[model samples]
Target: MPDHQQRIAYLLARYADKTCSREELDELFSAIGQGDGPEGLEQLLEEIWQARHPAPEIDYEAVYRQIKPAVPVRKTIPLKRIAIAASLLLLAGTAYWLLPSKRTGKQATVLIQPAQRRILPATNKAVLTLSDGTTVPLDSTGKQLIQQGNVAIRQQNGQLLYASQPTDGNIHYNKLTTPRGGQFRLVLPDGTKVWLNSASMLRYPTTFSGKERVVELDGQGYFEIAANAQQPFKVKVRDMEVLVLGTDFDVMAYGDENSVNTTLLTGSILVKEGSTKQLLQPGQQAVIDNQDHQLTVKTADIRKVTAWKNGMFVFNDMALPAILREVARWYDVDIVYKASPGAELYGGGIGRDLQLADVLALLEGNGFNHFGIEGRKVIVLP
Candidate 1:
């Protein structure tokens, strides 16, 4: 092994033995961040995990809380990339190593068993509701759904495509909705692309005929509008409206959430909540409070905001309840908290492709909480 690889091995051995100092932990995280080939390191870690013997249980939550400030800064890495690195550490079983309790000054032991039931992650699936209340299920399988004059609606390569030329005066609308454990992509008549997250809906006209193209959104969706200087694009979500000529942005208007967030990625957008309006620049996010309807703009965490679109979950010091809500949505499970989870904050990255049991295992290994899977419910134990 190279000198750096040897150093990582040494650190891993010390980490597994619960002998690494706080400085060594920081060094280990920094080394992992700087590694050129994460796959090799992952393999090496797996080998070490397999070769290791049974040891006393450890409290990973306390250790993580202690070393959070030492987590290496890697702004250039994508959240999914960080997920690979973080998942490896969490899965290797070394992350749960011994740490003395702050209060008792004695090592705490926590054993988190694997979940009994298996629940898979969300997939590309949606339902298309026509203007006349007709509904059609859609998936990756390519098929033509309907034809209206010069326009045809079809599904191909997991995307709902609208193929049309300029039609007559008659206008028709369609609504695409995804269920709890589902997501989908769409191509509008004007070549605009849309990605709908889990439990989201998008409603739009089949063909653009007016000076302004308008669409209604009920949940989360990422849009890349087709450029048409003559016809500006507009998205209406409840009382708020987003107006743009040609831009890339994401809107999260889930009813359960306390606020509607609009994050701008490219170009400018005018957000209108009734008479009040705020023009947002790229890399900025507009937050509208649901109670007071107050609108505010601030710098956005681009990677964390967009991680869902790239099949990853990035938690940046998110509350435990909020994290469980996300887990429930993606896994299509009910979260039953038997005890108050308190105000604990969690930070990490994990792939969205993992099964429910695997995700729970990663979270439970933190040693702050225990979880049990019963049917379609995820129980948070005391």
Candidate 2:
């Protein structure tokens, strides 16, 4: 840190938290001169100053000091010169950006780490209106069941619940929906847990009517079915049927609008659409094209696909639409594309708790596109 860069770093640290006034910030940034400066010993005073003050005044010395990567010890060299040499190790943004992100990025991962805290995006959400017309709000608030007569309609954790008696055979249906950018979880009566993706829905009878435990799903859900060899678990989506004796799998059956992807995590299951039958083993994902009556099987990365249920936001070679789709759902926000930057595959990690602003900044910083908030909606400025 040549004294100036150290000062700049101090200022950025303070300004980042809104501790610095506007004038102080502008002057601090101006000193960086494209975020680089000649590096040399910052003097014992600069180190002493930083230690005395947890956050010192903005100076170039601090800026240079902070960005520098560490160097290993070698034969005979003083520590002070080593420090300055290390500061020069810090690269310009372009150098840092060279690391791949499936797309080009303007900044390095270190520069992008702090921007994770974001403003939540605007998206639609739906509440379950029970048969009695009582609405159950869905959010992070855990498992809750609303009783209605002989039926127990509640949400266990993120999964929907229907604790209906076997002999009662009362025919009632419950709807599960995720608006544009919201997701939910529910536990079915047969001990089948479902994780609903955003902007999707599921409708099912409160009681098992036939000899099978059946449910109709409209969006996406991950199911951990309770094994019942005698009474199999059947998932009816659009017009397709997925029968499982006992398995842990995920189904992306959003009607005929999108491809139905059934990924089996464990156990064997059979997928059926009309007259066609497709058997799936662990790690296999069956993509069903309802419009064409076609089903295709391929290897899948289940962690990236099923991370939503576990409160993780994962993207592995996912296109922009697919990545943003998950972000929109968890953050519960509407996405208005500012421009059309499509089909670019993205790979990285972010949290479900991130605000819309942070997520947008991440995308923009990482070379996807820029975004802004219009009132509550997230306007993706392509």
Candidate 3:
């Protein structure tokens, strides 16, 4: 909406175009230095600077323009892309398979055919921060099984599982934390499974505290609460509280975000922020704002909302800056754009198990853009 946001859209559109000149690249770097760039934009500048010069073999700019009109950037993206690549390792550090080689045509084509990707790398992992402020990193490590009170918990593939029965007067408390670049899944003692996104934290009793199961969550999470009419599962996110009588839904309450969204898949929920209260049913979403109690409800698509838990990054009508923020985390890479933000709000796509390069390629398919990756970070330029 703002000029800066529009500029960011344009910058992302031409990020990978190799024909962007040195002066053009410097202009981008200067614009970003003006503090209008995306969150991690600066970190990606070096990578983007690399692409400012032309590549040897092909003219990347020419290729970009050809695809630009075909995939027009819009105010609101129409088709969504599911871009999460499956983990190269399934679980316990087991390598699933190797990426397809660049081999193509002639002798290579005759030698082997490209195999379909089965499962992509799952960007799921979390840490448990004790109430004492000491955080316990929960990865594929930890003993096979750990017992705390009546809870039988274990870690499988970076997910923490709590298998315990409801008991009276349970007092221990624990928090599940998803770090800046990780996500995780867990089944509570009561069978309410939760998928936590990056930079999130979930706090709960080692056992259900009272008749109602209460938990505190920061950032975003998807929940599938076990059906128990007697005991409603309640989640406290920032100023809002979501109470459900056993339902499947997703909650996005990241602190940095202006509004918290609660999307229901099956069943219903009551979301309350301040004096404001909203009801949501299946295929419905409720938005509660932090600044003003502005609330909006509309038809919901749970699939797009819960795609992350299912191992995909689904974006519908998302801006390039918005999309890249998520990408920076999952791919463990940073991004910088060199063109204008008004170029387009990228229509999202699904890249099942796509490599960092492949994922960027799809975005580049819409415009003249090239990416430079060093270590875990990436930069895009035009």
Which prediction has the highest lDDT against the true structure?
1
TM-scores of the candidates in the order shown: 0.77, 0.65, 0.64
Candidate whose TM-score is highest: 1
Per-residue lDDT over 1-382 for candidate 2, one digit per residue giving the tens place of the 0 to 100 score = 4566567657645533334553564464344332233453244334544554444244444433332221223424444443333332222211011111345535422122234334454232457866555667776655676776677776544546666466464577777777766776667777677777777777776666578888778777888888888889898886788999998999876542457788999999999877888899899998877668788889987866676665455666666666666665566556677688655665534544445665565566656566666554666664
For residues 64-136, what per-residue lDDT tens digits would candidate 3 score against the true structure?
3322222223323211110000110111111111111121211111111133211124355677764456666
- Backbone steric clashes in candidate 2, count: 45
What would the per-residue lDDT of candidate 1 be over residues 161-240, giving only the tens digit for each residue?
89867777778889999999999999999999999999899999999987999999998999999999999999999999
Clashing pairs in 1: none
Candidate 3 has an lDDT of 0.59
Give lDDT for model 1. 0.75
Where in model 3 is the C-alpha error above 4 Å?
Answer: 1-122, 132-134, 141-143, 165-170, 368-370, 374-376
The better candidate by TM-score, 2 or 3, is 2
